[model samples]
Target: MRLTIDHRTTYRFTAPQGRVVQLLRMTPRNTHDQTVAAWDINIDCDARLREHRDGFGNITTMLYAEGPLSGIEISVSGEVVTSSSSGVLHGTFEPLPAALFLRSTPATHAEPALAAFAQAATVGRAPIAALHALNAAVHERFTLVDGRPEAGLTVTAAFARETATARDLAQMFVAAARAAGFPARYVTGYCDALPNGRPTPHGWADAWVEGLGWVGFDPTLGRSPEAHHVRVAVALDAAGCSPVAGSRLGEGREWLDVEVQVSGQD
Candidate 1:
């Protein structure tokens, strides 16, 4: 399958700023199952973009802009070709050991209730089957919602809700999988399966199975990711792999708008 993606993020501030700096994990890397064919990032204003890799081995771009500016627009467009991998990752860069993903971040901390739920959901099953069960359980537990995820929402809080955004569901799955004794991490990427375009990129989880290495899981879809999924960044939690994280020197208030479109063809 060939996939095309167009993503734009805009930030408008009530007060002009002196400077802005951002770290972006919006670029996808090539793996055995997916190949980046073409990619570009455009900033509406004068800015400097430096490419580098983060600790998690994700391709990152650092943006620096001088201000007195009211707003900034960051746009990214790309094309990628992917093949069905049955959710098993291969030929991807791995900078850290799988055990590192087992470490929990604040956003993915599993409280007692969540931990117990994980235990109950996966009991009496083999590792792979248990992971599938946990994924389905997480999917069944929430009413999937769309739009930007609530900032700083933790897994425990999200798990308590009857509705959750993709980010929340992914984080919940990561937390639960870790509690179930599986080394898991959060993933931020794009999926071509949505009928309508989305305002934000997709989110999911990946777990390290002993014999299988890393395998993808989408609690939002209640299945493993395949050709329709374009894998990007992976980290202990969403914040660690956020597509954009930045700070402005001056700030009164700011409004953000995001638009994303992902389409695929065989």
Candidate 2:
């Protein structure tokens, strides 16, 4: 299957700033069961981007822009080829030891509700079945509310409290898989939506199996990702894996708007 993705982030503020810099993790690396037939990155604004592999072996981009300017915008577009492999992952570099994934992050800490979900996913050793079951359980247990989370509230706490946004569910998926003794990570990406301009909030979780490599599971959608999913960046938590993470030097306040569109081009 061939997939195409378009992501645009725009920022408009009341006042201009002096200098701005950001870290971008928008590039998708190759792993077994997936291929990057074509990949491209572009910045409409005046900025310089440098590529570097992080400590976890995940690709990272350092973008720097300096100006006595105001608002800025950043966008990304790409395509990929994919196929099924029993949800097995293979052929990807691992920087940190597999044990590192078992540890909890700010987003996926200890919680009773999340622990129970993870136990359900581990009923069988089959990677496909475990991940599939996890996805189904997540979808049924929580509702996809339309509001963001309060500051300092991790998905683990949110699960116990029975409240979450798309990102919160994503964190829950990762935490549950890790609790099941799998090297699971959090994924940030885009999901294609209906043509009627319906809202499509994209987020998911990835698990590392010995034979396979890094397989993705979208608990919110109740399934392993197929051709329509476009992966951007992954990390131990949702905050670290954000497509754009940076700060701007300004005086007044800042406003941000993000738009993502994905399509099955094939």
Candidate 3:
């Protein structure tokens, strides 16, 4: 399958800002499951973009803009050809060991509730089977809420609400997978499976299997990602895998807006 993606992010500040810096994890790399045919990033203002690879082997761009300015716009577009990989990541770079992902972050720390739930879901099961069960269990446990969370909520908080955004859902999945003795990481990218070709950025979990390597599980969709899931970045937590993150100088208040469109090709 072939897919085209367009993602734009706009930032508006109530007061004029002096400088803006951003880390962009919006580029997808070539892997066994997908090939990047073309990709580009554009900014409304003059800025320098430096490319690097993060510890999780994700392509990252460092963006810098000097401003006595009020706002900035960043746009990214790309075409990718993808094939089904049965959720296994092949031909992907892994600079960090899988065990590194076992380390918990505040957002993904398995609290008592999470630990008990994971234990109940995977007790006495084999690794692969237990991972699958945990994935399905998480899917059944929480509803996918529309829109972003008002704030970045921890996995435990999201699990308690009975509804969660994709990021929180992935965090919950990662926490549960770790509690079940599987090394898991958070993945962020674009997904083309939404209704009416309405593209949205997505988050999922990757669990390391003894023989299968890194296998993806998307609890928001209650299954593994396939051709429609475009993998971009992976990290121990959502903050680290965020599509865009950075700091600004001289800010009173800032507002952000994001728009995305994804469509399938014939």
Which candidate gets the maximum TM-score versus the true structure?
1
Candidate 3: where are CA atoms >4 Å away? 195-198
Candidate models: Cα lDDT each: 0.93, 0.73, 0.87
Choose 1 or 2, whichever is better by lDDT: 1
lDDT of 2 by residue, 1-266 (tens): 67777777777767887778888788888766457777667766688889988776768888787866577877777777766654445566667777678888866885776787678666855876787788788877886675444556687577875656777777888888888888888777766632243444377888877666677777767777766666667678888787778778888788777776676765
Candidate 3 C-alpha lDDT tens digits along 1-266: 89899999998999998999999999999999999999999999989999999878899999999988699999999999998878888988898888888899988899999999999999999888888889899988877776765566888888788777778888999998998788999998888885342356878899999888999999888888889888899999988889889789985998988888887775
Q: Give residue 162's error in model 2 in angstroms.
A: 4.4
| lDDT at position 36, candidate 2 | 79
lDDT of 3 at 127: 85
> Measured by C-alpha RMSD in angstroms, how accurate is candidate 3?
1.4
By TM-score, the candidates rank as 1, 3, 2
Cα TM-score of candidate 1: 0.98
- How large an RMSD does model 2 have? 2.8
